[model samples]
Structure formats: structure tokens, C-alpha cells
Target: MRCPSRARRTRALLSALIVSVFAVFCGGEIASAQQEPSAPQPVSAVQLQSAIAKLGDLDYSARTNASRLVRRTPAAQAVPALIQAVSEHGDGYVRYRALVLLSGFNDPRAKDSMRESLTSPNDRLRAVAYSFFEHNPDRALIPQFVTAFDTEQGEFVRPAVARALAAAAAGDGVEVAAARQALIRDVARGEDFFRSSVIEALGDYKAAFALDAITSVAKLDGPLQDDAALALGKIGDKRALETLAAIQRTASRQTQPSIAAAICLLGVNCSSHESYLVETLKFTDRNAGYQELLRAAATGLGALGVAGHQEAAASLFDVGIPATEDSTRAPVALAVATIALRSTRLMMTLLEQYADREKAVALLAEGFDMLEEDLDKERFFAVARRTYWESDGASPRRVLMQTLIGTLDF
Candidate 1:
């Protein structure tokens, strides 16, 4: 045991063992640092159940936080629990929140839950059901929606029903014509709130046939006036220009942004109107009244971005660049990303045209980060991913978009 050669051999082996252990530990750290993040572990059954239960928490912040946690659950794992909660949750509010969360998944499995909720006694649940169908329009549901629209007395629920009807009308299939007429009548009469909703849907669907009805609404002096004007512009019919311009001249400051946005959408005096929108966002005194006005202007810019206005994208960046607060910056970021995601070419061209391309990319990435719902963020991600793969691999725009999409963690 005391022999010199044995002692030397023992020391060498121990030293080698220590080196091997150190290498393994340090190498793992290095590999982890370089690797893409691992897929999140599935939430345990108990944890998921607890989170689902919290969906109905009395505290608003608590409920919101719980919602965020449940939404982050992988769709494959979350769908079953969500469907169950939506279907069998004892609490009405929990059932409503579960359905709302489930709708975000947009899974075919949740369709039955959503359909059943269409007749739910809870007005909020009924509203969410109508909203789900608004995006996932089924011509088959048109007759049922028509009946609901006639009978739905809940103010909030009726507007959603109106939107669903408008969506069904946009689809190419049976009963579309009937859906269209129902939607028009909905705007022409019905409660102001319901009519406002139908007007919005017409604008969203670009129902040029509803132009006469929307124009009449635009001429009226009230809340629907702005909604109808915006709808007219979305229809892209130059015929509405005279009406929009006339409204702008007499519209109050609060209503002016909506009118200006409509005029810009029609490509008439866009520069002036665009400048006006930018000016609206530039106000330093953000009191409650100013905040309301700012939100309105932000919404206008979002509409413009959706319409693929490159200049408006630049303007969004211009407004977003200096904003420090997340609340202040979120709308601007969302507007910028909305424009960029419209098309790969538009994104590239818009960024290249911006004063600072680096900041443009950063802002777009930030916009992706600000998407509230995981499903919404996923949609934008899918669009960005599709555009990236479709473009020439060697194109600079492709490279730029790839970089931008890479920055999106959602």
C-alpha cells in the first residue's frame, strides 16, 4: 500500500476522475447555453385543476393570472381539461372563463363545447360562443344565428350575435344571401349597440353591398356615425369619400380620428390624415381624456396597418420608438407588427424605408411579445413562419424576417 509506483498510479487515476467530472459538468452548462430551450414540461393534473379552478377567482388580478397560466399549457394538454371545465364546471363564471380560454385554442375538439354554449343561460357564455363563431364562421349555423339575433336580448350578447351573422354572411355557401340581408337589417334598425356591432362587421368583411346602409348610419349624429364612416372606408369604395370628407369637416375632435382614418383608407389626402393621426399620438398630456383619444388614434393606426399602409407602419414605429412604458408602447407595437405581418415584401420594404431599420426590427419583435393571448401570438407566428419559408432563402428580406421571427418566444 505504501509503494511509490502504486501511490503515483492512484494519484493519476484520481486526478483523471476529477478532470472527467469537471468536463461533464462544464460541458453540460455549455451545451445548455447554446441549445434552444427545451419544451415546457406538461402541467401536472393537480396543478392544472387548481389553475382551472382559479379561473373564477373573485379577484380580477388573480383570475387574470390564472388565465395566463392556463393559456400557457400546451394545447394538446390543455384542450381536454378546458373542454371538461367548459362542459361541466359547476360555477357559471368558471364555465364562461373556461370557454373563453378554450376558444383561444381554436381546436376542433372544443367545437361541441362552443356549440352547446350558444344557448348557455349565462349571458357572458353566450357572448363568447357567438364570438367564437364570428371567427370560425359556419354557413350551417346561419339559420340558428338568425334566430338568436332576433331573440337575444342581452345587450352584450346581441352584438356578438350580429358579428357572427356578418361572418357567416361572408362565407360562400347556403343561406349567405339571407345572412347578408339580416345583417343589413340589423344595422338599419335594432338597438344602437347591436347596430354598431353590425356596422363594424360590415366594415370588417368589406361588405360593399351594405354601403348604402352604412352610409346612412355615417350621416347620423351619434356613436354609430364614426363606426359607419370607418366601415365605408374599409369597403374601399371611393363613392364614400364625399360622405367621409363631409363628416371630417364637422366631426368633433373625438370623432375626427375615425373620420381621418377612413379618409386615409380611401387614399384621399392620406398624407394630411396620416400626419393628423401621428399628431394625435404625440400629445404629452395623457390625462384620462387624452388617454381615451390616444387609444382611439392607436386603433386607427392599427386599422391602417391591417390595410397594408407602409407609411402608417413607419408612423407607428415613429410613435413607438420613444415610448418607455409597456402600456404606452403596446398599441404602437401591435400596430407595427400587424403591418409587418401583412406580407414579407411589405415588411422588408417598410423596414428598409424606416429611419432606423434596427429599431424597426426590435419594435416588431416587441409587438410579437405584446400579444395578449398565446393563440393570437401563434397566429402571427404562423404567418411569419409561412412567409419566411415561402420567400427566396437568399433574399435579404427573408433573412430579416427570419431574424425577426426568431426573436419571438411565443
Candidate 2:
């Protein structure tokens, strides 16, 4: 299901927010991607096999160097070897790494290995398979996903299953429709963690069918209510405005920022909600533990900016360009960077129409600055390149995306 244009603005914003928030609070990788460096030259098949074997080497450096060689090998040679390693490697880590590299190839031959890996004894492999299906949705595999939904119990793996099912539900077919209903059922009655997973994926995919169910969950003053409200916003149906407004008035202070964001996303009474997010971000009492609130506000503003909220982008530039603290600046920079990268046409229009070009570019640079690791920058730009190629050839966004790539490569 395609989101209304407004909801599409939040697409990449949501992904970036999740990555930034997790890194800030949980100390996790920011925007993780199973990316590899550009290939140098083709290696002999024997040499490639040796490198693949070293993927499971006991020495960390050996494994690391082996990954580089394997990744840099041309896909014609690397893909088949990776597929073979995924199937027959003695070490589970080697198998997992092989599958990850295979995903980058975008070759159809890797599908069987990906499908079989779903049943692997390794939890990590199963998680990777679910992620693979999420990106490569196959109607033929809907039954397999349904089975995984029923039986998969790994904490991390289950969410991947939910994401895959939600993505598959985006297709047109009776089986897909059934899969959609089952997903809503899971959201309604699944255990706490699982429900959260399903709800998030539904929102991420902008599944319109789950609106009423998500709205009902929003009305209840339960733990899932916030997630439900966010999903409703992402679904982008204005009909949920009344439900969102009601919850906003009575929700706890900590949750209001998210509700406000959801309300803004619907493009109704957005200015007030945007103001509320700014106030929440500028809240001064740091010792009282309001960092979560700040992150929420930053994420919300990022969504607004990406959605073509010129005012929201202005606010981010003002607050983020000069900010120093990681807790405060990192999320803001991410918001600004997303606006520049994901909504290139809109961002370019804003910069041209307004006078914030230099400052906005500076803030955009700050976003990259936050990505200290070379791997993280590579993943971020890799995503940018994919998005650029995927966009319409004649679109202004495509042109601006190319400009962004050159401007930000430093």
C-alpha cells in the first residue's frame, strides 16, 4: 500500500530515527548495513575459496581481511562462492557472512540459499533470511513466512519475520490479503514484544488495512498505544485524527511528543504540534532524564522536515547547526541529513527558496561528521546510491540526489 505523499516523507526518516535512537540510548551500530568495499580485481577461484575459508578464522584480523577480499571479488565469482559457503561452510559465522555478502549482489540465484537459511539452526542466519525476504518479497514464500510467524521464537528473529510479512502484504493477491489480516491479528493479540514488532512494520510499510485495529490500540491507555498512534499517523488516513487528538490530550507527558508527531504527519494542525516538538527538544532540565524526550522531538522534527515542512527544517537548522552535545546534536544532524538525502528535491527547493543554503549544508556536513566510522559512511552513501538509482530518471529528486552525492562525498 502506498502512503499518501505526506506519509512517504516519513519513510526514510523513520529508519534513520530508529538507527539514531538505538545508538544513542542502547549503544548500538548506527544505520547498520552489510556493505562491502568496491572490488579491486578478480581473484583465482582457489584464492577466493581460501578467503571464504578464512571468514571463520580464529584471528580477528584474518577474518576481517578475508571479508574484504571476498567482498571485493567480482560478484560473478563472489556470488556463487558465497552461495556455496552459505550452504556448506562448517562455521555458522562464515555461513552468515556469506549470506550477507550475497544480499548485496541482488542476484536471483541467492534466493534458494536465502530460503533454506530460514530453517537454519542458527538464529542469526534465520534473522538474515527474514530480512532478505523483507527486501525481496515473494508471494510464493508467503506460506513460508506464515509458518515462520507461527513458529519462529528468536527475540531478534521474530521482528524480522514480522517485517517480511508486512512487506509481502504490500502485494496484490488473495494470499497476500490473508497474510495482511493475520498480521493485524498478531498486532492485536500477540505478546507484548511481538505486537510491538508487527505494529512497527505495519507503520513502516504504511499498511492501510490495519488502521482501525491500530486506532483501537491507540485508544487504549496501554503500552502499545503509542506505537498504535504512530502507526496510524504513518498509515496517513485523516480519519484517525480524532482518535489521535483524544489520545494526545490525555497521554502522559513522556508520550505526548510522539503523539504530536503523529498528528503533524497527518497534515492537520501541524504548526501547533511542531511547536510542541520544538519545546520538547529545547526543554532545559537535562538532569531529570529527558534525553528520550529530546530524541523523540528530534525524530519528529526530522519527519516534519522531510515531509516538506519548511518551518520544521528551519528549526532543525537553527538548533542543530551550532549544537555540540551528542545527545542533542546527533539526532538533529541525522534529521537534517535525512532531509537532504531522502527528500532531495524538496530540500533543494527549500534551500533555493530560502536563504539557509550555507547553514543547511553545514548541518548536513555535521550529520556525516557524526558517522565516525568509514563503514557507517559507506552504508549511508550506499543507501543514497540505491535510492538515487531507484527514483524516476526524469525526476528532479534524482538530479538533486546526484548533486547531494557529490557535495557530501567529503
Candidate 3:
């Protein structure tokens, strides 16, 4: 090519440099544009307020969605708003939802609102507040619960207050003596509505001093008496065991099973009670008056099973097979499942009794649900699959097998 003029050559070089710079800048911009955005932080106060209000939405799904959103918000910003919603909200369900959401936040900032709700004149609010304490117990709030239990007069409030007291007492840094005394006073003199809760609280606290008071209540004939006997049994004291034995002897047939359950729970020598429990299982009559006794006996057998008593499992299996009474089958099946967890081979033995494969599969499904540990669930699933097989693709047993396998995956 012919030599260009110096100015023209300089201009061409400048133009090339400009193009190169432009290409580099554009490439950087394109790369920046292609990158993913960071997750968005929680929305502002106004948006959170909107979400809180949506909690009261007439549509159930909308309210549930709002709850999920509120739960994800930063605890510092969300706790106060949630507490206010629980305290000042007009809709009962919305307030209840707020209380439920507040439970997820471990922040102590929500305590004041919880205390306010605990003392609220509204029974439902008080109940939710107590339930909140159950999930998020604060040792500092123990005295407040004790005071609430002392003064709260509403029947609905009493049970909640009792539960709150129990939760707070169980926590560290609580004055055990004061909590025990408060529970005992309520069990002895509080209204009948509070009695069952206070009795249970005593058992949780293992208040040995309250033994005499609990024993006195165990003497009377009512649901409260059964609760008292159970409480004494949980205390696991020698005196408590002796008192339960006395109640077993003196109580009518209707009440004896509960006493027997208490005795069994105490880990006493329950051979006599075991015989009684097994006898109760032999009766196949579902409509008979002895149904309550049968349930109580089955419950006792399950307790024994928990203690790893092999005979209890055998007895439960005996009752579960050929259990014509639909009402009794659930308890018997549950007991067998409970024992089967301890003795894996016992499950196969129990399954063998049910000639009806469907019923056997149903009981296996129930057992799967009752097992809390994942390892145990997997073990059970493996055993169940190997035991039952369907050569036919259309077999209904396949459905049960699939369901059992799904539990392990979940």
C-alpha cells in the first residue's frame, strides 16, 4: 500500500485504540450483567406491617402464607410487631397465629408481651400465652407464672396457667420449692378446673413434699383421682407406690385399672397387675362396660413394654391377633408396636398372628408412624418389605409397601 500521511496514520492508530478500550469496557459490563443477584433482605416496616395484617386475612391459605413470611423476618424487627399483634389484634385467630409465630423467635424481647397476654382477661389469649411458655420457657418468668396461677380464676385459664407453671418450673434458675408449693396449693385448694394440670405439674417437678396432697386426691373417685394416681406414680416414691397399691385394692373395678397403671409406672413388682392386665385383654367385647378398663390395661402393658418386659409384648400380641373389637385393636396394636421396637423379632411374630394380610399391613403402618427415630424407622421398613411381598403388580399390599418405603425417604 502507498505510505499514508503522518496525520492520517496517527488518526487511524487513535481510532484502533478507542475501539480496543470500548471492547474491554463492554465485555466487563456484559459479565457484570450476567451475574446472579444476592438474596433480598427482609422488607421494610410498612411491608412487615402489611404482612402482619394479612395474618387476619379471611382466607386460610393467605393467613398461612403470611405466617410463613413473618417467621422469616429478622427477630429484632419482627418480635415487637408480632407481640403487638398478639396483644392488640382484634381477631382471635390472628392473635393466636401471631403467638404461634412468636414462638420461633428465641429473643427475650417478646417476654413482656407474653406476660401481658398471660394476664389478659381473655381466656383464649391466656391459653395461647401459656402454650407459648411451654415451647419457649424462660427461667426468669417462673415467678410471673406462679403469680398468674395464684390469681387467675377463669376455668379455661387455670389449665393453661398450670401448664405454664410446669414448664417454668422445669427450666433452670427457677425456685423449685416455690413452684412446687404453688402447684401443691392449687392441687389442694384450687378450683377443679386447675386440679388435673397442677397434679401433672407436681409429677413433672417430682415434688416429694406434695406426696401427701397428691395421695389425698388419689383417694377420691373421678378423673382427677386417676390423674392424681398417675402423678404419684411418676413421683416414683415408695410411699407413692404403697398408696397406689392401696387404691388398687380399694377402688372399684372402674377405677382399678388406672391405679394399676400407676403401680406399673412406678416400676414395682407388677406380676399381679400384669395378670390383671392380660386378663383385661382377653375380653373381646367392645361394647361392654369394661372398655375403659381394657384401654387402661393396654396402656399399662405399653408402659411395661417401655421397661423392656418381654411378657408385656407377648400379652399385647395375644390381644392384637383375632382382635374382633375394632375399638380395642388400636390400643393393642400400639402396645405391640411399642414392644416391637425393643425386640425387633417380636414384630414378625406379631405380624404372623394376623391371617388377614391387610390388617397386618395396617398395624405395620401404625407402627411406622409411632417410631420417632429414623434408624428405627428404616430398620422397620426393611423388615416389613422382606416379610410381605406381592408377585401381582395389582395387589393392594403394594400400596402399603410403598407407603412404608416413603416414610424412610421422608
Candidate 4:
């Protein structure tokens, strides 16, 4: 399709741009080490906020971390600029960062913009808007979000509304029973897509009203099973443990990984089925579930915080690589690698070349275990690893791996 061709050219252009810009822009990295400043820069808080508000175009010339400096200025000023970017920007990356910056702020206007974005005809724009609204409460807009779900023609945008409404239902407590009933009705009739989004929206909600409903939905046929299973994992209540354990017992090896991950996250600590991950790793299903188990294993390993944890994650990472036949395996490996390398520089390199959706895709975890501290590092390594793994025999990752092995040997 014409769209694919355009995206290929854009990615090629962007990759070239990243390499050329890195030396000129990123050579001076931000040091996390605390230091007492000798003198302050000339920019005042007011002036800085003004500059952030006035900048009409995306500063593509700035380093990859430019958005952080912009965010640190002031939310009152930054929110308006970000709202404008969502309304007008041409570049998806720029719009994405602006929204990321907006996520930290608590301006009332942002809620309106977010509401509008939820209903935006543009799918990508709607995605950006929902990303910000996900965190930080915006309760009054639940009705708006719910309406968008049934009326909107944009396939991508409708899900965001469902999620936003679901989050609102969890946070705002407005007509919660009615909302629960509506979602339950949909689930009963086999509206798996809407039901999944609704369950996902109810993350961390321990209310008795929803728990029984979610559990019952999990028992249903079709994809809602996975959705309910994932939601139960997010709730992290002990009540779901037995259900998850049963699910893990009966689930195909492919489905078991997700069930395990859900259980690990939602089940009571490392107590319930902690060994579920370890027991399953020995099998090789090669579907998305195989990757899910690796991810769940990495999470469990990270949580276990023992020598064996690292060993288990590393071994799983090795098996996951060499890229499985199904392209979905790439993101699966990336997530597992992320869990395996949490808090280490190993993850920093993995996220660099990460791209989403079009053509060859790479998946990443934005909030997986304190990734923000070393976000650029994660991006750099992601790019470096994927580029190395995908190219001919000679590439950055292979050469780097060789150097690392030699050093370890020495």
C-alpha cells in the first residue's frame, strides 16, 4: 500500500536523522549525579514558561531529551503549548513528547483538550490525547468518553474512549453500577473488543461490585478470557489468585504465560504461583504466549531479586532472540529483555531503535521499572540491539557483543 511505502521512506529518513543528530546534539548527556551549581543560567521561570508557550513548531533540532527541559519550566505554560501541538503538529514524535510533557501537569483546560482528543477523527492524535488522560484524574468527562465509544467511526479512537471511560468509572465513581452493568451486558453478548477495553480500564479497582463481574467475564468464551485474566492481575488481590491458578492450570502453554503474568502482578506477592513462571519456562510454544512467559519470568525474576532471577531472565532472553517466525515475537523479547535488565544500562540500549506498528515493528515498556531515569539509554540500546540483530552479520550489536565477551573473558 501507498501508506506503507511512505512510512518506510519516513523511517529511513528519521533513522538517518537520529544518527547525524546524535553527535551534534546528544554528545553532551545530562548527568544524573547531583551537583551544586556555580551560577544559574539567564532564563527565568517566567521567561522559560513564556518560551515554552510561544514555540510554534516542534524543536526537532534539540536533543532527544529536549522535552524534559521544557517540562521542568512550568505546567501552566506547558499545557497550552502541548494542547496546541495536539491540535496542529505534523510530526507524531513531537506530538507524542508534548503529550508526555503534559501528562505531568494538572491543568483543567487539559481535560477539555483530552476530551476533544478522545473524539478526534485522527486515530494517532486520539492516541496521544488518551495517553495523557490515562494518569491524573479527569472525572467529569466520563459521559463524553462513553458516548464517543458508541458513536465514533474511528476504530482506534473508540477504544481510547472506552478506556478513558473505564478509568473514569474507576476513579470518579459516577454511576459506577450502571457503567458496570453496561460493560457486563456487552461482555455477555460477546462484544469482546469493547469488553476487553472496559476491563483494562478497571485496573487496580478492588471494589466488590466489579471483581465478581470481572471474574465471571474471565470464565466466558473468546478473548474476554485474556482480558479478564489481565485485569485480575492488575487488581493484585489475593481473591483472584485461585482463579488465576486454575486458569494457569487449564490454559494452553501459549495462554499460560499471560495468565502467569496476570497472576504474578495481581496475585498476592511472590506467595501464590511464583513458581508458575519457572515451571513453564522449560516449554517452547513459539507463539505470543512464549514471549509473554519470558516477560512474566523477567518480572518475577526482577521481583525475586536473587542471583537465580538474573540467570533465569538471561537464559530466557537468549532463547527469545534469533527472532521467532511470528513478528509479534520481537516485542515479546523486548519486554522480557526489559524485565531482565531492569535498572541496568542493558535496557537503555534496547529502546533506541524501537518503532511501533508500521512495517518491521519493535515494542517497548515505557514505565517498566523506573525506565525514565535512563530513558534515552533504553532507547539507544533498543535501537542498537534491533539494528544489530536484524542486519547482515556485521552490525553494531554483533560488534558490541564481541567486545563485551572479550572484556568479560579478560
Which candidate leads the pack in TM-score? 2
The digit string of per-residue lDDT tens for model 3 on 1-410 reads 00111122233334434544654766722111111112213778998888888877876446645654675577778888988888788877677667656655656776676677776666766776776675567667777877877777775566666766766665334475577678777787845545766776566446677789989999887657766886776667877876787777777775665577568767676787777777876763344667656656665666556555667766776666667654566556555554554455654454444445455545544443433222233335434444334324444444444443332221
User: Would you list the C-alpha lDDT of every candidate in the order shown?
Assistant: 0.68, 0.70, 0.60, 0.46
Better by TM-score, candidate 3 or 1: 1
lDDT of 2 at 273: 92
Residue 67 in model 1: lDDT: 65
Q: In candidate 4, what are the lDDT values of residues 212-325, reduced to their tens digit?
A: 778886665445566577667666666888888787677654455456656656535444444665555434334444544443443343333221234334433444444444
lDDT of 4: 0.46
How does candidate 1 fare on TM-score? Answer: 0.68
- In lDDT terms, which candidate is top? 2
TM-score to native of every candidate shown: 0.68, 0.71, 0.57, 0.54
Backbone clash pairs for candidate 1 read none
Cα lDDT of model 1 by residue, 58-150, tens digit: 864467556656765788888899999987889998988788777666579878887898988898888777777877887888999988978
Evaluated at residue 382, the lDDT of candidate 3 is 39
Candidate 3 regions with alpha-carbon error over 4 angstroms: 1-81, 105-108, 134-143, 167-178, 221-223, 270-287, 294-410
RMSD in order of candidates: 17.3, 7.5, 24.2, 11.9
